[model samples]
Target: MGRQCITEVGLWLPSLRPGVEEWQQMLSSLGQLYVQGVKVDWLALDREYSREKVALPTYPFQRQRYWVESSEGSDKTTTKHPSATASSPITELLDRGDYQQLTAMLSEKESLTAVEVVQQLIHLHQKAVAQTALRDCLYHIEWQIKPLDVASEKPSQDGQWLIIGGEVTVTQKLAEQLEQKQQSCRFVKELPQDYSELLQLVQQETELPLVGIVYLNCEEVTSHEEVLSQTETTCQSLLELLQALLQDESSNPTKVWVVTAGAVALGEHPISVAQTPLWGMGKVVSLEHPELWGGLIDLEPSKDVESQMEYLITELLNPDADDQIVYRREERYVPRLVPSSPSTSKTFKAEPTGSYLITGGLGSLGLKVANWLVQQGARHLILLSRRGLTEETEAAVAALQEAGNKVSVMSADVAEITDMERVWKQIQAEEKPLKGIIHAAGVGRLDTLEELTPEVWEAVLRPKVKGGWNLHQLSSSENLDFFVCFSSIASVWGSAGQAHYAAGNQFLDGLMHYRSSLGLPGLAINWGPWAGGGMVTAEAEEWLAQTGLETLSPELAISALEYLMSADQVQVTVSQNDWSHFKAMYALKRPRPLLDLITVAAERVEAKTEQAPNLQQRLEVVAETQRSELLRQILQEEVALVLDLPITSRPNPEVGFFDMGMDSLMAVELQKRMSKLLGVNLSSTLTFDLPNIEKLEKYIIDQHLVGFFKPETDEDQQEESFLETNLLAEIEQSSDQELEGSIDQILESIID
Candidate 1:
């Protein structure tokens, strides 16, 4: 074996830096060692020469070349230009409209580098396209394809998930569960507690790729003060945040889910009152922006946090789930329903021995309540108003005093804490302990969201939001028999042009719940528009009537309140609504969850829709003269209805609607009824516009029934013929009163 000198022959071992000759020599040495029967001890050999571990790259880059030709129809020679690198494979895919593959490449882990490169290219391309389109549209007077003109891409599912307002434990658990499922989540540890901060946060985070936002209810509050603070803070923050998010054009979150306590699902929980405003506002928010809402999830108090969180995550991740309001009970999550509960009586009596406070007491509804209280055996009543005494209010107060109830008129702004404190001091010093309170103070203005200025919003919120809070804080320890808040159906149904009003009333509803939780007597009544004495304007009333809501008679409303006072209920909606009519009006954009409570109306709406075309067609075919006649008849009938007179007593065609005892409310009702019946859009001032039946009939015929029919003779010719006719001779021969009587008789005969 050419006895290998141990010193000259290196040990047969792998080397970090090895040449081919060294490897050959090592092989020769290994052969010699094996032939000489030298048994190699593997464990004894030095292992220190092992390769050092190198840290793996965070992300691997695949150096694949991507390029595209500048011109699509170019020859092979034109494709060789170096400047052609402007377009990449990603841009090519976008140009070809293969978005699915692009989205897949962006989502797959193996193609992360490709995704970054593609995203940059796509962004550049989009910018170029947008600039070109805008420039062309603005300067060239040409129709161009703009960004919004392009088909919208489906929302990316890989964006960061946001968890807002959940308990620390529950949010943490939810985050862990999401991570386990390999989903990316960003937990919002703290949310803005004030409206300004909330608005700033929303503006700052408007560009974040937030796929979803899940809002959990705040922790339970123990004190009434805390309840009011937390509830108002949360609600205001939510309102501002939503307004910001909806207004954001850069990157609005794809979905928003509000998770609250199950008390709202059950329809009453005093401790849950602070959260109820969010529920009401959430419903309106969903209706206002259906595309951004995921759903409302209410977690049962008795359910385990871990399980509820698990179920919540599942629902949040699901894209096809239909239910918008869900309730978690024990082991399963189910859809929630706002079921109507039968009125139940509770043993309670209103003792009129002590003084009672009523805010907005000089308003129409307030006076009615004051009189009702007097009739109910209340002796002392303290009425508060910003405007202490008008002629109308003075007369009302005099009547109440004569009816044997001692009335004190106080002029103060209930929304002002100082004013409220002064009033409370005066009440305590001069009168008996306050036995009851009715918070009926509120202001309503109608304007679209775009027209809502901060001043207008604050004006509407002052009396309702601020006043309710002031009263609740001051009266928390009053031990009163009843703390009643006069809320409105706007909060329940979310009336158009009344967002602020609705939000303000919703806060009152929430405060009622909070009061109940403290074992204090509280009741919130959401009354419909009042027929006789209420703050509702004639225009607003007309709109409400068109939507199938009848004005509640003062007598009926007072009776309902009296009955509600004896019931063991925290909140009640007292309204005589025609669900069928309301549904028909909103058939195209009906609000869910709330509308789900009126399923019976859906069929009626469908039937109305099926019959609507036939009615329209019939009207379209009627001759102009006949159509005018039909409109005149409808006008007469509506006028009769408004006046509470027999249809046979229809007024003269030449007499003005106002002259026939048609006040603003009656005129509004007449306009509403005529508008609905004739399928014509009429303004609240329709009676004022034409004034008399003949002029209104002519205007309707010309504006709505034109081109379908024509008069047999010209207007001048008809007037000339009328002057020469026997009717003119009779009118000229008769006395003025007799002629007027004759005209009335003729009108009556025509209607009959």
Candidate 2:
């Protein structure tokens, strides 16, 4: 047992000879060899009774999830349309209302007459409409606390724990907790400035097989300046750790658990918003390299750890296939998308007196947000882009100006302080102060997990991570109405082939939370792909559609942005998908606990139907005098519950629902609550049309009639945003700034 003693274990004893007893624990070595599939002679290698004959399970013992491309040789550029889609046979039949043919095709009632078929189709339609309410809006995820029972001993507790962070007291406590369970942990208290050095540090620390890498190096960051500093230090450390771990594929997979105190608000606790971005980063890591990924744990925002500490140790050792876990005092939580509506905040309108700045303003999303600001009667709007305006962009700017808004296009790189400083100088020069900032400028690059080098990390991380910092730093002193960042759903839910993209958006989410924690006006909307423009490529949009996630149309996207201007929450993911189609992606792939929301939502709908009924009939039976007030009271309470406001708070009768804080979350909840109470199905947008208490009550009295709804759609046609073409072309034609400026002015004059 010369080499096998170190490589394979339980073969050599502590007394320098082959013996079974006397505190000679070679359990970690055996576990590493067993998991690695390196078979060892049991009786030959050790004493007869020393080795335990363990029972193996029918399913694989290794509980970690891994995903690969199941749809091999699939086209990224084309959407797979079935019979129900735009060009499908079902569409033609449905559009024409050809009930007889459809009934003949789908039903066994071939003997039925055309009239009967029509009657059957009408009945089917009615049935579908009544029950589709919850199914239509069940993908929204929120956090819920659930108790977990972790056993005293987990069978697969091998390898040493490596905690990478400062010598903070909480980290020390975590290490002690790990060792208490007879596990070894190493402390790498400092990280170097360079990636190679960071990699070297990991190599030196993990000579033996590693059980997990615990990252508890984060501190509470509340200011934008701290965001800049921490992005350089803290964010880089996490990236370096991941890069290093990927390089070293040890015998036993070394999973990473990024722990943060106050990174999340489980209940009514204040959060260390700066630490939240790591969740976004950790999500991508889990997706890109599931083999090296553990889950993310957020302890209660406190130092005195009791049961939360116990829960942490248990979760670190025995994660229940859940990637996101939170522990509050005596309570445990996992994330799931519950059927909550998009939220509404206090009503906020663009100020005519102050200027609004849109960074990356030349990009599609930025331009649209600028146009939206103009629609809100915003007088002076400044658009910041690093690139000189191209011909199409010039035309777009002219159109914005034609709408009687001062839309200035300034050239400045958001990541560079000097460039941002130049732009900031001009912004301060304005007669009116800058009121709001929308950071929409970012680049999208396609790289597989292996392709994500440190340079790639820098390129992708710089804009959102660094640019976000610059904006935060420059405007830290100003009283901004809204400091909105256009984060992406890629960060919230890990996207394939978008590792860097997810990381960047994740940084924005974290930055927003940090700002919000500091009592600043910050909101990060984790948006899905925009339909017509911005960073969405044809291939990407097709992929998104294939996954059942709809690309958010610009009109709809902007309306949401406008509505959530001052939303209560710092970070929120905004996207739409019917769970019917979206759940199929995960069917063959890895488990997503967040998607457990769809199940919960479905159960809730089932319970609602089974538990109670006939609310509307009961109201009619009551005196007509009290009917209006009762319905109104129900609406108020439901809205309040969804918004997380006081249950007693009521919406103003004259003010609009959105104005009184109604978003998709409140909207859907109100619809469900009303549907259950009225004993009839109400559309999800019941509040959207009947926006006030008077309108809502009137509609309720008049049989819960829904009003006309205009969908927020974008141009059917789409073009690639600046990252692919304009930015590159401008970089080559840098000497010709004069032509670009003249073209913009001329375009504006012609429009005028």
The TM-scores, one per candidate, come to: 0.54, 0.59
Backbone clash numbers for all candidates listed: 1, 6
lDDT of 2 at 712: 22
Model 2 lDDT-worst window of ten: 56-65
**Whose TM-score is greatest here?**
2
Per-residue lDDT tens digits for candidate 2, residues 1-752, read 46665775444333433555434446555656667767655535555466655332211111222576587635533322211122334445799999676766555744888787676665444333322322232133477877665655557555678777755566677788888887777665566555456445555765656678878744666666675666556666777767766666455677888877776655556666567667767777776677688888887776554435677787887777688888766678888766544556576688999999998888888888887788576889888877758887999999988877888889888999899989889999889899999998888887766566668767887888879888988999887988999888778777767777876787787677667767888888888666775688876687666666766545446556655675566766667664544553432134566776564234133233322434454344334444555555656555666676665566567887677766544555666666666655554446655777788777765654333111223421122343447766764565445555767886787456
* Model 1: per-residue Cα lDDT at residue 606: 20
lDDT of each candidate versus the true structure: 0.64, 0.67
| Alpha carbon deviation, residue 99, candidate 2 (Å) | 33
- Score residue 686 of candidate 2 by CA lDDT: 64
- Looking at model 1, which ten-residue stretch has the lowest summed lDDT? 136-145
Give candidate 2 misplaced runs (Cα > 4 Å): 1-141, 151-153, 168-173, 192-208, 222-226, 249-251, 265-270, 304-309, 342-348, 566-569, 587-589, 599-752
